[model samples]
Target: MDEQTFWELVDRTGPDPANLERLADELSDHAAADIRDFADHLARALHALDTPAHYHAVATSGASFLGVRCAAVAAGNRAYRKVLGAPAALATYTGSPGDQLLPVAERAYRTSTRADWQHQTAVSTHTGSNVAAWGTSWLHPHMGTTTVEGLAPQDYMIALRHVALTLDADPAWRSWWRQSGLTACELGIVAEGRLDHLRPSADIRRCADRLRANFTCASPHGGADLSARAVSEVRSMFEVIRQAMSMPGLPPTPPVPTLPADVPEVPVTAKPLAAMPAELEPQGYLTLTQIQEFFG
Candidate 1:
């Protein structure tokens, strides 16, 4: 359905699940294409609210923030506009009141004998940055586009270690990190590793040593155990960092040499490399130079 009609339906439904069955029935009458259009409009509305200011105003980030935005849209067009005008209005959306909208299209589709829902949008709205001019700004007004390279290795680790410990202590914060798909600590570790790999530095090694020592002392036990969620996230983060490092303007991947055909061929046993320390693992990381160029 068109954006105006879709929102009119939402206002009639009154942001409550009680109106869902009736709403689904109404939507069932429309062409199946409109069902997908409803989803696209909903996605755009939700994405519009995915701003740092909105997140800051609601005192939440990630999926919880998305839920609050959903609640705003479920509040209907006028209420959603109110929120866009004043982000602090989001403070009122404490519950998952808008969750009903999430499944409305699917329910409508299931009840009808029409074709399956097809996405007509150019970009997938499931994830990624909001596609609005007022969306996320790369430059922080107070920080004024500071680059990661500005901080010394030791100074950065001290700050990162503090945050890592904080994340370790609070399950909620860790859960948020899990949703974000990477912890600040994980990024810091990867950044340090990738930079050191490109150019070895004694300072980075010393900082890593100090960080491990501090981590040991922070917990009553030797160190906090990494959760399975964190382990999986870190593994993915590492691959992402490695790929980023191989991007344009950074180092190019070396070509593998071809071996000449010889009279005898031998199968070589590869030597196992020593395991990286949990805190110092160099899997996924960002480069300071890359950040410098980006922020500049």
Candidate 2:
């Protein structure tokens, strides 16, 4: 499925989150994989050179014939379930119409009945900028010898699609994902959890920080450039987030090297690593500056 079809699928549903569970079926001929690949196209297209990138971009990014907010929620939820635990805690938080999600922690309480979910209570702000700025891990569950540097855009799409399909398989997760405001908050959860105990790559955190810092939607030149950058980085970061999260449907990614308990922090001025640990040396994680820089 291409970008146009993806939006067309979403446009038929309008903005109601309630209609999402059945949304994938709307693309009748498409498989779960197609729905996910469509999400990749939609994400890239929404933040295209012509489109604007805003927090609300998912809701209002496209023109009248196509608004992508609901589609983004579907794609994001599909990706979300593959995260570290896909937390049972997250499942408890059913979204609603008038959710007070600002302080994040407050929203967590209102969304979930469980008390143990406090770890994720802060939502996106759960990890302050300083923490992510310090260091991040580029690791995956069940080491398939995966590293963020070696990933392709399709690889990210596959992982996210896996999550979407996984959630689709479970009626409960899909039900909550279809609720109002859950998709947005869930994306926020994915973003905030980047630095959680899952051991995200410091490179991802740095990139995310830079993306937020450089974002300026008001200025013409600034917004255009920022939109372009957001497009690239969001794709890259989702893959990074996938690496940080769990992979469900794909093959096992090879493990990189054993990382130290305290992963070293990358300096802003420093280039990607020139070398990698012996285990990763044979892979481009050693030879390629792009792969080695972030995960080494």
lDDT on C-alpha atoms for all candidate structures: 0.46, 0.29
Give a tens-digit lDDT track for model 1, residues 19-88. 8788899988887778778877877787777654575555432225556777888887888999998978
Cα lDDT of model 2 by residue, 92-198, tens digit: 22232211112222223323333332232111221112223212211111101132232222223223322322222233433432332222111211111111213
Q: Model 2: which ten-residue window has the lowest total lDDT?
A: 211-220
User: Mind sharing the TM-score for model 2?
Assistant: 0.22
Model 2, global lDDT:
0.29
Error of 2 at 140 (Å): 28
Candidate 1: worst 10 consecutive residues by lDDT? 211-220
Error of 2 at 69 (Å): 5.7
Q: Evaluated with lDDT, which candidate comes out highest?
A: 1
